[model samples]
Target: MKKNILLIGGSYGIGLELVKQLSEDYSVYVASRTSEGLEGTSATHITFDANTDSLDITALPNEIHGFAYCPGSINLKPFKMMSLDTFESDMQLNFFNMVKIVKDTLPLMTAGGAIVLFSTVAVGSGMPYHTSVAAAKGAVEGFAKALAAEYAPNIRVNVIAPSLVNTPLAKRLLSNDKKIEMMSQRHPLKRIGEVEDIANTAAFLLCEKSSWITGQVIGVDGGMSTLNLS
Candidate 1:
């Protein structure tokens, strides 16, 4: 039987890549605000708005083999200039929304199933102008670890922290050639991350190949989180 996987925000970016890759072996259900970019794919598209609406659990299957929450925020600002609303909004989008989706979908996950959530390299490396997003993703890392512990022997939970991936959500940061080159130079790998860089790791964790791994935050950030080869 084909495994069923749910991707909460798979309309684009890393999520879309996951849908494309995983669809070759699994039945992928993608939920996001719009169905654009998901056309002509084997994956099923379900309309969802994580910011203004709650997850529609009724559309999910009774036995889910994997779940990935890919929605996130990138509110980069100086700590002193950041507003409380900015912090709160980031938390809502990155952490709280994921929590709600996981809680509602837990019942549908089969034993030994996997859950993947996204964080950021900033959470561990402490980059400048990442206060809001870092704070939100930091909570996600903590939540993923705790949830992994609580759901042990049944469900597996993990997080992927990536640095400056080239995605639509990050277009502004990499809009110009100069900005792209500058961002690329910051990483030890000397290149910005690609969606597949994170998506492939996510797919591994969701499969039985990583069945023994749980409660961990794996960095897919091109060695940016642990290296400083300046």
Candidate 2:
């Protein structure tokens, strides 16, 4: 039987791209609120809403080889403008939901299994108006590191911290050519990240190639987290 990979949200953007790329090599199962952008792929889709529903493991294999939590938020607002509810909402979606998924899936994961979580560049780079998202993603990073340590020699866990990828989640930021160019120029790479850029890293992390790598927060950003080219 093929190794099974359970993805929490693979219906759009980087998650969708990862599902498409991993389907050829693994049995891909995607649980998301909608199955948009997954047309013609070999991935199996199960209707799920992370906010309102729990993952049904009946669709997963008895031995899960890989898992990825692809759900995240990019709530940006100044400290004073951000409400307590805004922070709570971000924590609920980005932090709590991931913890829930991992606990629910840990039992079925096989030895050497990999768990990939999503974070944001803002978590380490400290950009303004990123308090909400950064806090939430920071929790993801911390959780991934601790989980990796406790589950070492069996299940490897890692987090991908990406900068402003051109996904539907960021449509407002990259709406026009002028805005796109302006945002792209902010990064040292001089271009925004494409879905493939992030997906490729995720694919590698989920495969046997990254067996020795664990407890790492890999930066798939366009050199934004560490580089300052002024």
Candidate 3:
């Protein structure tokens, strides 16, 4: 039987890639705020808005094999200039919204089902102008671990913390050649990340091959998180 997997916020970027790749082998259900005319013939698109306080969980399947929360924010600004509303908004989108979705979908997840969430390398290692996003993603890391521990032997939870991926979300950071070169040089790999780099990891985690992994924060940042080629 094809594994039933639901990808939230999968209209574009890594989420879109996952839907495309996974649809080849698994049944994929995509949910996002706005409808996306995705080209995957095998995937199903569902109307979902994470910002809404009231959501109908019954709209989803009764048994889900995997779930990926792909919603995120790239708000990078100085701490002094950032307002509380900005911080709260980021947290709501990246952390709290994910929490609500997982809670509502818990009953639908089969035994051994997994959950994957996106974070940023800034959450672990400090970065300038990343206070709001870092704080929000930091909460996701915490949530993943706690849920992983609590649901051990039944469900798996993991996070992918990436740096400078070339997605629409990061386009502003790499719009100009100078900006692109600056970001590329910051990492030991000498280039920003690609969506495939992260999407592949998501597919692995959702599949049975990574059944043993849980509560882990895997960094797909091209050696930026751990390596220093000085």
Q: Report the lDDT tens digits of candidate 3 across residue range 1-230.
A: 78799988788899988887798888888888765547635677788789885456666777899999998999888899999999999999998998998988888999989999999999889999999999999999999999999999899999999999988888889899999999999999999999899999999999899999999999999899999799
- Estimate the lDDT of model 2: 0.92
TM-score against native, each model: 0.98, 0.98, 0.96
C-alpha lDDT values of all predictions: 0.92, 0.92, 0.89
How many clashes does the backbone of model 3 have?
Answer: 0
Order of all candidates by TM-score, from best down to worst?
2, 1, 3
Name the lDDT value of residue 227 in candidate 1: 85
lDDT of 1 by residue, 1-230 (tens): 89999999998999999999899899999989888789989988888888887777888777999999999889888899999999999999998888888888898999989999999998998788999999999999999999999999899999999999999999999999999999999889999999999999999999999999999999998899888797
Clash number for each model: 0, 0, 0
Q: List ranges where model 2 is wrong by over 4 Å.
A: none
Kindly give the stretch of ten consecutive residues in candidate 2 with the minimal lDDT sum: 69-78
Model 1 worst lDDT window (10 residues): 53-62
